[model samples]
Target: MSDVRVHNFSISLDGFATGAGQAPDAPFGHAGERLHEWMFATRFWHEMGGGRGGSGGTDNAFAAMHGPGVGAEIMGAGKFGPPGWQDDPAYKGAWGADPPFHTPVFVLTHRPRPSIEMEGGTTFHFLDASPAEALKRAREAAGGQDVRLGGGPSVIRDFLAEGLVDHMHVVQVPIVLGRGVRLWDGLESLEETYDIEAVSAPSGVTHLTFTAKSR
Candidate 1:
């Protein structure tokens, strides 16, 4: 069965998706990277880079839940934002030599940009279309496989509030952003119906999986 999943999505104790002053200078933000410290020790993460000999523990189990994905992903423009790329014709893509995502990645953006093709079966498609359109295109490209919503808070909340996202995995970290970007800022209405299927992980991070249909 085709499944749309948000795997290993990190969040802070205060519900912040990212820390203050987030920009190109800080990839994960000032203190935002702290949210994903749980995943850093996972064997799955290590294996993704072709590394070996990892500790199998709670963090590993938490990371393992993301699985084994489907085929495609949808992300917001914030994931890769840069004014320089818009001008330089020589600029290929944000991802360096070999990015982990070896599949079709649809980036939601209003400004039109040329489609970027990369090695390892990855292609960056800038979608001027709405979020629904992008997800539809991604689902078709998935070919019956699952489509993941690789988000930047706003995107994920939009999908959830719109009931477009089928399933999601929210992994909460012990840290607090204090004052920053939040995951479910204005989507409190979603809390009434969206049901959490499971909540597990002996690791420091709390893993919560939710399904919209369960409502």
Candidate 2:
């Protein structure tokens, strides 16, 4: 079976994945680009933007793992857009016309909508299903490749709680956001089931990889 993996997920020292007051302009809210500054400095990000000159160090090494061998992606509605995006029928997504995920992307939402096919191979399919159900659909669309779990924290938490994730890479940024959406809330003793390894990069962020023990 293809593994379900998460890569380059960023969180603050306080475990907050995203900050409060998320508007159209403030995507990461009060946290701004602090959580992703390390990623932005990576060559992977620069190359994605059709640019040059970026760090080719450990940050780039980690950021570059976001894609590859992933046939589908499952992301939360929060990751799709800011709050109340469902109200706007014209809202495509936060990623403009061409999203980074060039696979079938399944969005978990209470209000499902018609799938939007973008310029690239990426297509947004909204679902009101549980984590398991959504994963089933994504796997079907994956065509025998691994499934990528794209997140904004809450969706990751839900999948973690259900033991649906096989591999996960989390980046702990050296900042403290006192108020925001947390990632570790309700997930206790998560280290037991998964083999966790931490590597501190020179950029002051720690990369934690969690691989589930043989089941």
Candidate 3:
């Protein structure tokens, strides 16, 4: 059976997945790269950046889980681009021509667009569908592999609310954004449905993994 998973999604100490005032120039808004600095120091991230210098520690181990077994991805519109990106017809996405996700990616948006085929086997399919509907499409596209719930907060929240996610990995960065798009809003007592484990990384960030308990 294919499972829905979220890997290495970062959140601030204040619970903001992304900072306020997000724009083309500042993708993560005022929060900047503070939320992802820990990942940047990982060997997995360094390799993604076309470099060969980074730590091979806990962070890298968790970051590397993002790939294997994932066949397709479902992400929010915000994860695909900055604010107002949908308005731009020429938007190639935040990852440029060669995205790290070398699989089918379904972006949830109000305005749907033609599918984009990028380098390294990545194809972006824009869809305006509910969480269940979108997951269905992604699962089909994934063939027999698991579908990854690539998020920018809202998407993950929606899936979690619907009790659709099977495994989730979140990295809690040690910074307080004060204000931004929060990941846990309205999601009271989420731990009740899942077996949650927390591990602190040497980088001061806590790696939280959630596995859905059998019903």
Candidate 4:
């Protein structure tokens, strides 16, 4: 069976994944790009830009795992764009023409839209289904490979709450957003479900992994 996983999902020291007031100008809101500074310094990030010059250490190794073995992705509407993105008929998504996800990307929204074929292998498919239903569709699209849970906090939390995620990697950036969408909200004693591992990197970020225990 293909596993459902999350990789390089950054959260603040306060457990917030994104700041409040996400608008067209401020995607990360008051938090800005602070939460993802560690990833931005990694070679994996630069290489995605079709360039060189990025660090190659623990952070890079972790960032590198974001792509491989992922045949399809399921993300929230918020991660697809800012507020009112569906309103705009011409919205191309947050990553523009060529998104990093070179697979079938399923966006979970109340209002489903037409599929979008980008420059890369990414083809956006909008759906208004529950976590299990969406995961089923994505797994079929994955063609026997793993399905990635591309999140924006709330989405991740929902899947986690439903016990749909098999593996998860969270990068804890050293910052306190105080207010915003939190990852750990309503998830108490999560260590019981998954064996958690913590590795602190040189960039002041802590890499956390949660692998579900065998049933």
Could you give candidate 3's per-residue lDDT for residues 1-215 as a string of tens digits? 79999998999988999999998889899999999889989999999878898999999999999999999999999999988888899787999889999999999999999999999999999999999999999999999999999998999999999999999999999888998899998889999999999999888999999999963
lDDT of 4 by residue, 1-215 (tens): 99999999999999999999999888888999999999999999999999999999999999999998999999999999999999998798998789999999999999898899999899999999999999999999999999999998989999999999999999999998998889998999889999999999999999999999963
Q: How do the residues 1-215 of candidate 1 rate in per-residue lDDT, one tens digit apiece? A: 56677888888888888777766666567775688767877787888778975659866776776646668888887775643455655665567657667888898877657778787777888888777788889998888888988888888988877678878888888787787778978876675666775555666678877777653
Local distance difference test, per candidate? Answer: 0.76, 0.94, 0.94, 0.94
Q: Count the backbone clashes (under 3 Å) in each candidate.
A: 0, 0, 0, 0
TM-score per candidate, chains pooled? 0.89, 0.98, 0.97, 0.98
- Backbone clashes in model 3, listed as residue pairs: none
lDDT of 1 at 121: 77
Q: Supply candidate 4's per-residue lDDT for 19.
A: 95
**TM-score between model 3 and native:** 0.97
Supply the global lDDT for candidate 4. 0.94
- Cα RMSD of all models vs. native, in order, equals 2.2, 0.8, 1.0, 0.8
Of 1 and 3, the candidate ahead on TM-score is 3
Which wins on lDDT, candidate 1 or candidate 4?
A: 4
The list of candidate 3 runs beyond 4 A from truth reads: none
